[model samples]
Target: MESNQTNRALIKATVIALSVAVVTLVLFILPAEYDIDPTGVGKKLGLTVFNQDGESPSAKTSTDGDQDTVVVTVPAGKGIEYKLSMMESQQVTYEWQTSNGELYVDLHGEPDGDNTGYFKSYTVATVESMKGSFVVPFNGSHGWYWKNNTDKDIDVQLIFSGEYIVEGLK
Candidate 1:
């Protein structure tokens, strides 16, 4: 009789653990459903930037797909803005198509800002929270800029990442 009771208790605990794991998998591990059309061009660039000088270390990720989809997301309750910090010896650009199928080209910083002067152009993608999802039509090859203003050389990393759905792009 005691052996049967011990077996029952073990089985109950196992079942409870399995249930908790299943709930977590369904609620947190799955990505949101996107009804976005993956055609066109100029928006396959996935660029991510991070504030290496912050205390908590925050980051924002953006992707420009064929639909001019420049989607940016930050951590919950945080702001995000794409500021181009370029030096005198740098040239950067991002190409995308507008909703009307026109070429949308964007540049960063000023023509004369060395390493210390913050560039002039700014694209605000300030996301307010974690529960955010948005897309914009984009289709092109975005360029980049670099200028070594410091007396010593610097290894600036230009982060670029993305994937485009080519209609049988062979």
Candidate 2:
């Protein structure tokens, strides 16, 4: 009879522990750590903005500065250049559009010590507008070179955000 009572007590304790663990996982671990809040509790707590890696979507995680938005013009048959100094693994969001017509764009990056004109190109296209994000692969200046491909003057409006230095934008 004593053995039966002891077995029952142990079983009850085990059940309670498992229940607590499930509750904790559903309420806290799922939402705060993995951004997988099925119960909506994590969203209510303002934790859903974080990713599964515990990183917020708009977090400035490096030496980059605040968001920057700049608008410039590329005269007919003329071109312009702009870039941001960024470190490896840093992230930035970018969106740009031409007011009138199309612009030939070259999005590329050059390493800090590269003086041989060696650069990596992210994209080369004739686009009226674009929006995207990038994770910097190496410490470098990354940006765009736009040439007005239209007959009349064109205005290129660029809007950007993230961890980057806009000290040298032209």
Candidate 3:
């Protein structure tokens, strides 16, 4: 009788442990790693950002050519992201300069429908100014993340001509 009771308890514990592990894998690991959100909780928590193949969704339709200039201030010891929504193969020429100090800059892109927090970095550097032309390789939001590490605020002037929709600061 005692052996039977012990066996039952051991089985119950094993089953419970397996159940918890499965729940964790489905609710957290799958969604965070593969963008598979069967229960939708991972997406709500902002964990899904990429697809199974680690690519963003299809490219959006291209827009007409446009030009814009924007000025923004980065607070001391702060960072900001500025983006442009562009279709695959869209081209843009851009120039950005800082008012007074150098900034840590990351130029990158993320796919349109990626829920699995994946991004491709095109450039990363600490600099005061940059001028370049880019042809987007995929349909996605492409732009820069600038971090001001100094004690004073830094103003950035960005001028660009492209076929894109400005996503501004984010």
TM values, all candidates: 0.26, 0.60, 0.62
Clashes of each: 24, 0, 8
lDDT of 3 by residue, 39-137 (tens): 999888755632323444323222534557778788799887878889898887899999999999999999999999999998899999999988889
Per-residue lDDT over 44-141 for candidate 2, one digit per residue giving the tens place of the 0 to 100 score: 87554334224233334335545666677777997867777888988878899988888999988899999999998888999899999888889988
33: Cα error in model 2, Å = 48
Where is model 3 more than 4 Å wrong at Cα? 1-66
For model 2, the local distance difference test gives 0.78
- Tell me the lDDT of candidate 3: 0.83
Look at candidate 2 and give me any clashing residue pairs.
Answer: none
The best candidate in terms of TM-score: 3
**lDDT, residue 23, model 3:** 95
Candidate lDDT values, in order? 0.30, 0.78, 0.83
Q: Model 2, stretches more than 4 Å misplaced?
A: 1-66
